[model samples]
Target: MRAAIGVWRWRRNPLRRTTDLVEAWVALVAVALLVLAVPAAGWISGTRTDASLQRAVQAQTRQRPVTTARVVRLAEAPAPGTQSPESAGEQPARRAVVATWSAPDGTTRTGTVATRRELSDPGDTFRLWTDLDGRPVTAPMRPETAHAHATIVGLLTAALAAVFVEAARRLVVRRLTHRRYRRLDRAWAEAGPDWGRTGAGS
Candidate 1:
């Protein structure tokens, strides 16, 4: 009730009738939705990397070898200087996740994940490496950071619902505002002393 009265008062004010403002709001929502979809892009990239790594691991080991192993501690990336979080910054991050892993050879080793991007975590099995000098290294290539396919589809549905809801809101607001103005205009038109007066000459 209070909201209706508030809108009634607002309808009397002509300043709020800017179609440009309404269009701007729609544009803003669309832009926000676009940005929210960025995670989907990242998921795609991760999927590709995950597939490639799966193929690589399958080739070397007889068994699947449980790709994602937990890092008992932070581990360095497999390649030197491959992990640098500060791509936008002047200097790259020298150190990555310092963790431990058990190699396929059954030897447990500890290293840091010094890759460009943040790689796997503790307990994620990955392809291990060693430099010419025999320094241990590991990089998180395959990170299964994806929800079920249904979940992705559901997100798209939700996004479409939001758009329709916004459109409906705008439409309702417009009709209510138009009704308010017609009521006010009719009242003003009948305000003249001669309007609706008892028949004088009739």
Candidate 2:
């Protein structure tokens, strides 16, 4: 807005320099890119990222399934006075337990796994995620998480675009200012001798 006003106010001024017009035009161009191009670039990048993440989510969900595991024994607890600060929180504490569960092929598998359940007795059941081969695996990415990642990517892209535009504008303006300064210096050098002499040029 200030750039537009500067352009209009200086349009008919006899004292206006070429650099002033160029600076105003540069500001206007930067504004146009920020207003129009930045959002488009961000949206396109975010859409592509979201689509790729969603595909990965689908693949993970299909490959991993929840299965029931029966606790055989609770693993050894930490020594007294050695617990982490997080143990005092309301969140359920995770503990390693030796558990057995049936594989997809109907074979019984037993392993030490971590669980948040308070059950300590054998035969206690808890849910576990495993690959098709019954190997323990983490849960698939949630759709909400994918969307959040996409949003962050979009915001970063937009911010980078704005930074680049401002940088270019400043670079061009700096060069113009230097050129103007050099011209003023040359003009002063040429007129310095006569400047202080009364009626020298007249």
Q: Largest lDDT belongs to which candidate?
A: 2
**Model 2 alpha-carbon miss at residue 188, Å:** 0.9
Per-prediction TM-score to the true structure, in the order listed? 0.29, 0.85
Runs off by more than 4 Å, candidate 1: 1-79, 84-126, 129-143, 148-160, 195-202
Query: How much is 181 displaced in model 1, in angstroms?
Result: 1.5
lDDT per residue, candidate 1, 1-202, as tens digits?
3334444555556666554344445445544544565445445554665566566544523333432233454543443453323242623433356655556566665555443233445444444444323345333223332233334555555566566656765776676668768877887777765667798337
Candidate 1 has its poorest 10 consecutive residues by lDDT at 137-146
Error of 1 at 21 (Å): 26
Candidate 2 weakest ten by summed lDDT: 78-87
lDDT of 1 at 107: 64
Task: List the candidate 2 regions with Cα displacement exceeding 4 Å.
Answer: 77-92, 119-121
The residue-level lDDT of candidate 1 at 56 comes to 59
Question: Model 2 misses residue 38 by how many Å?
Answer: 2.1
Backbone clashes (count) for model 1: 35
lDDT for 106 in candidate 2 is 79
